[model samples]
Target: MELGKIERLLDRYDEGETSIAEEKLLREYFLSEDVPEHLRSYQLMFRFSASQAEEKLENKPKVVSKRNWYSWTSIAAILIVALGIFFYNDSSRMLNDNGLGTISDEELALQKTKETLHMVAQIMNEGKSDLVYLKEFNNTKNKIIQID
Candidate 1:
């Protein structure tokens, strides 16, 4: 190829407007031993590309299917839904069976609360009686020690 034509192709290649055929021609021109000194710097780049194209991988690449990923994701979603349903039903059943369901009568609830509070009060009063005896014993011990 004429030097002028090669220079035009190089300009087009630099501008990223060259067709594949033009690029191939440039590569061939650069790879020749007769490349002019001014264009010799570009020979290494073309040689490197040619070498890369001819190079082969030692091991073939492994290919994974998209369907397998989808299957696992689907199974996980199903398991999560199943677990949620199971816990919801179990909790609802426990609430009804254990008499923890809705209590509609406000009066009955108030009466139950009063009884519970009364029981707690009685237990506290019994403890208070024991504390009274403890206090008397401590007072008598202190009086005896003062006399000695």
Candidate 2:
């Protein structure tokens, strides 16, 4: 409120050292209708500073340059090509005109066991369906004989 205090605050403000609360106080004091005409110029300064502070920054985050874009694109392309080449080479190595390498004895035995179990399951399912059809056929045959 005192002229000396206001002058000190103004000095702090000019040095960009004023806290937000201090700045608000300054703005309110300078904007009041009772403000002395001698201090009128300072009112404009605070108003401008406040408006400038509130302004939304233009080009926030800035545009990515073409060179940076090209660099990242080329890096991604190279990685993709490397991945493709690695997978292709690995697959090619795993295969040949004769097919993949011969299985180990243990692996062969396991495969044989899997195939046997699959065939057995298939046979059991087929027998179950056949039994169901036979039962139905016998019932119909008996009814026909009875009708006769």
Candidate 3:
């Protein structure tokens, strides 16, 4: 009841020797309106602790159903997998239906002709590039092996 006793109890509390019930008692005493002037300094601290202990309607968190959460997640995963497979199969079918499918005899002949033309063009370009490099190399060698 006295501030000195309360101070001693608080000292014991600081040393971690006070029980939960003793702490509650201290909180109740401090929260009371008639708290002594000497103990007024601790009123806020005890009142805060007391208020913290009181359960409020808003304190409890909103609960979600685990079964529903799992069900939705599974459905989403299945939809993603199904969509991936559908798109992949559709693209494969599209590619086969287009000109990229296995060539017939006439298409094979046309493809060969196109390939031959491309090969000839590549060979001609490569020859021109090589000739340019060869000419530069010859000039460098001639400079290095300078004649009288």
lDDT of 2 by residue, 1-148 (tens): 8877888998999999999999888998886666667788998887787789899977779789999999999999999999998877556666676645555689887998899899999999988987988899999999999999
Candidate with maximal TM-score: 1
Candidate 1 residue lDDT tens string, 8-55:
998999999999999999998998989888987788889999999999
Worst 10 residues of 2 by lDDT: 94-103
Q: Model 3: per-residue lDDT, tens digit, 94-131?
A: 56455774567998889898998999999999878879
**Native-vs-model 2 lDDT?**
0.86
> Which residue pairs in candidate 1 have backbone atoms (N, alpha carbon, C) closer than 3 angstroms, thus clashing?
none
Highest-scoring model, lDDT: 1
Whole-model Cα lDDT of every candidate shown, in order: 0.89, 0.86, 0.83
Model 3 segments beyond 4 Å from truth? 33-38, 52-55, 58-60, 89-148
1 or 3, greater by lDDT: 1
Task: Give TM-scores for every candidate, taking all chains together and pairing residue i with residue i.
Answer: 0.54, 0.35, 0.49
| C-alpha RMSD by candidate, in order | 19.9, 19.2, 13.9
- Stretches of candidate 1 off by over 4 Å are 89-148
State the displacement of the C-alpha of residue 47, model 1, in Å, after optimal TM-score superposition. 0.7
